[model samples]
Target chain A: MDLIKVGMADLAVCKAPQKLITTGLGSCVGVCLYDLEKKVGGLAHIMLPDSTQAKSVQNVAKYADTGIVATIEKLMALGVDRSRILAKIAGGAQMFNFAGTSNIMRIGERNVEAVKKQLEQLKIKLVAEDTGGNFGRTIIFDPQNGQLHIRTINQGEKTI
Target chain B: MEFENLNNLQKDALKEIGNIGAGNAATSLSTLLNKRINMAVPNIFILPFSQVVELMGGAEKPVAGGYLQVSGIAPMSMLFVLPEDSLKLFLNILIGKPMSEKIQLDEMDISVLKEITNILAGSYLTALNGFTNIEFNPSVPALAFDMAGAILGNVLQLYGEVSDYALVIESIFMEEEKEVKGHFFLLPEPGTLEIMLQKLGVVF
Candidate 1:
């Protein structure tokens, strides 16, 4: 099976037997969308929750709001039915407790909320999620099964 | 002060700032650990966010990281990263723990590392303040043992909303005759560069 790597602020789409991987997801959220019938999948590593906070409009995959929309549009362009698309999300960890001391520090939770809201607005069902913790995660998504395998430092590995 | 358009003189000025800051940090670390620490010349780079992890030997490299947010006129982020193996060696030296290649860090170990990061970051900021005469204080350092890419992604996220490129000052340090090694990263917020330059009396 071929593995496609997604970097920070990046996104990728692939077909069955091709897995999507993103590493070291601290406060960032990884959104994975898959169509069971088409066996097609897309993954986005979104760094921030909103694009409006940015100075310039660029790299739609870097922000949760734009990244999710872009990923869905990419999936639809590949002929996957928007109605059949389901999402499995992972990451969005706090990574540090000091970040919880203030609202601006809670980027992980904010990213998760923004991602979910974007999915809801797009009418995509969020089938599974493993998010909101004080640890970093590396995630791999198998397009064939739509299974997200999450790996953390002390917690070992879990698939959902 | 866009990092993307920095002239050679500005880049050199940043490198010098990194040099002085890392030098002070190394001294503080040496004093804390009571061992001589040698640091390489600091390197300043303007890189796309995607390539930042490659500086630490890839996204998946197991690393222990300490992150701090500096709040002041020129806000920035500071990161101290040590490879897992190097961390074991460092801990062994710091607390007289028996050495093991793949030892899992306990709570006490994490605390010690965080304290070390705090002191080092404090000294680094102090030196920069001395040079530029600016007041910047570091927040409580947060520790995470994870993939290098992940820890750095958290630091870079603050800048991701503003620009695609990041100004990174990187320095590598090693304990003399020991296997302990670490990387220090200084990521100043955008427009802060101009502030720093102006304070240093550099026009750009």
Candidate 2:
């Protein structure tokens, strides 16, 4: 099976027999979208919640608002049906114990909210998610089976 | 300040900052441990966000990270990171007892780690202040013992809004014959480097 790796503030899309993976998501989130009929998948590793907060949008895959939309568009451009698209997100962990102390501390929660909000705005169904914790996660999405594999340092691997 | 547009002289200025800052930090650490710690002159790297995890020894590598927000006229993010064996050595020095590499840190250990960051961060900023007269104040250091990519990525995310490129000043600290290894990363916020450079009369 072919493997496509998505880096921070980056996105990738692939068809059947290809897999998408992103590693080490702390406050950042990894958005995985799979097409049920086409067996196509797209993954975006987003760093921030919204693009409006940035002075300039250098990379669309860096924010939840723009990154989700960009991922969906890329997936659709690959001939996947928008109606058949389902989302599974992982990461967006606090990664630290300092609660409510700074803006970056709360960014994990904000990114989760923004991603869900963006998915709703675009009318995409969020089928599964493993998010919001105090640990880091590495996720892999298989396009053939639409199974998202999540891994952590202390926590064992699980497929959602 | 465009990160890609920095000239050689501007880059040298950045390297000097790393040299002086790390020099001060190593002294504080040496005093704390009651042993001599040697640090090489730091490296100045201007890299894209995607390549940062690789800079930290890949995404899944375990690391003990100290994250701090440097707030002043020029806001920035600062980090002190140590690998597993290195962290074990560091904790062993602090508690005056052998620390197992597999053992998890307790609340008391976390406090010691956080306080160490405070000392290091203070020394770095003080050194920078002496150079550019920029009064950079560091916030309470936050500790994370997790994947290197996670801690490093989150530190980069502190000013993720406008940072397409990270200006990282990286320094390595070692205790006699490289017994311990640690890294200090001083990531100036977007445009902060330009201000510091201007203050130092270095035009790019």
Candidate 3:
């Protein structure tokens, strides 16, 4: 099958194709997970830091907490073992503004922290990460090559 | 100066206000997408916070939501509402994937959506301020929950009924032969409508 295009607030999993990708992550985070033996890969492009404030079950997969868990569930559905999955994450930039009280709301930093905490709780080893900066990022995950590429506004493309 | 209170006549008069606002927004979108955008007449409404969910007509409710909430020491604040699907399309267009066959809303899409909201809201506010000679600044865009209930609960708790008025404007975005609807919300102070009518010089 051709490479699938994943949209905002979405998640996707692939088995044989071995490549799952997403783009344009500002305050959002793109989490790439791969199980080499099963050749299963999953990617989640999450926006919000947590789903605790979500109003419905539908938004669970839209927030970081639910988005990551949904991705893992899809990968496991593909027969990938939870223990064998390794994670790589990118994007969480503070794009604009510095108001004091709401500044601490910091969705970008909170998203990164939420991803880390969620992955650790799931016992998913985070092998690589590229996060936190003043710029936006465009990321691609190639499961076939086990490579994740990140391109920033000012920075050139580099493998993570 | 005290802001004038909003009434039915003033509320109806400002229906065309967002037409100009969206036109300005479309200009920005054209530059960013490198495609001309044909924006349509804007849809305007005034309701309470609880009406936001019912207003977004569809069975497939948006999985994600974003907000640019600003609270001024002057006791005035603004909330910008963003849906997830339109956000995906906006980002996909920017990344050279403007015509993706299957666009699914995801986390990555929401971040970009927030940025886009920041741009649109900034432009909208600037246009409104410039046109009305009002002085206001937007706070940073924050993550709004998908659940309408919780989101409104938080707003009501902080703002206290907000004078029972909310303004929602809808416009169609036509770019590269594709048409999409974009919505903007304004919950101005009680007297904002009256001030706007006076500025427009409505004889009535």
TM-score of each model, paired residue for residue:
0.96, 0.96, 0.54
Best by DockQ: 2
Residue pairs in candidate 2 whose N, alpha carbon or C atoms collide under 3 angstroms: none
Alpha-carbon deviation at B62 in model 3, angstroms: 25
lDDT of 2 by residue, A21-52 (tens): 88888988899988968889999998999999
DockQ winner between 2 and 3, please give it: 2
TM-score of chain B of each: 0.97, 0.96, 0.70
Give residue A122's lDDT in candidate 3 (0 to 100).
Answer: 88
lDDT of 1 by residue, B36-71 (tens): 999999999899998988998888888999988899
Report the lDDT tens digits of candidate 1 across residue range A72-98: 899999999989999999988877667
Candidate 2 local distance difference test against the native: 0.87
Model 1 chain A worst lDDT window (10 residues) = A96-105
Computed on C-alphas against the true complex, the DockQ of each candidate is 0.67, 0.74, 0.03
Global lDDT of each candidate: 0.89, 0.87, 0.61
Model 3 per-residue lDDT tens digits across residues B123-181: 76677666776656676665542333323323322322123234555555666666444
In model 1, the runs with Cα more than 4 Å from the true position are: none
Q: Comparing 2 and 3 by lDDT, which wins?
A: 2
DockQ-based ranking = 2, 1, 3
Reference-based lDDT, residue B31, model 1: 87
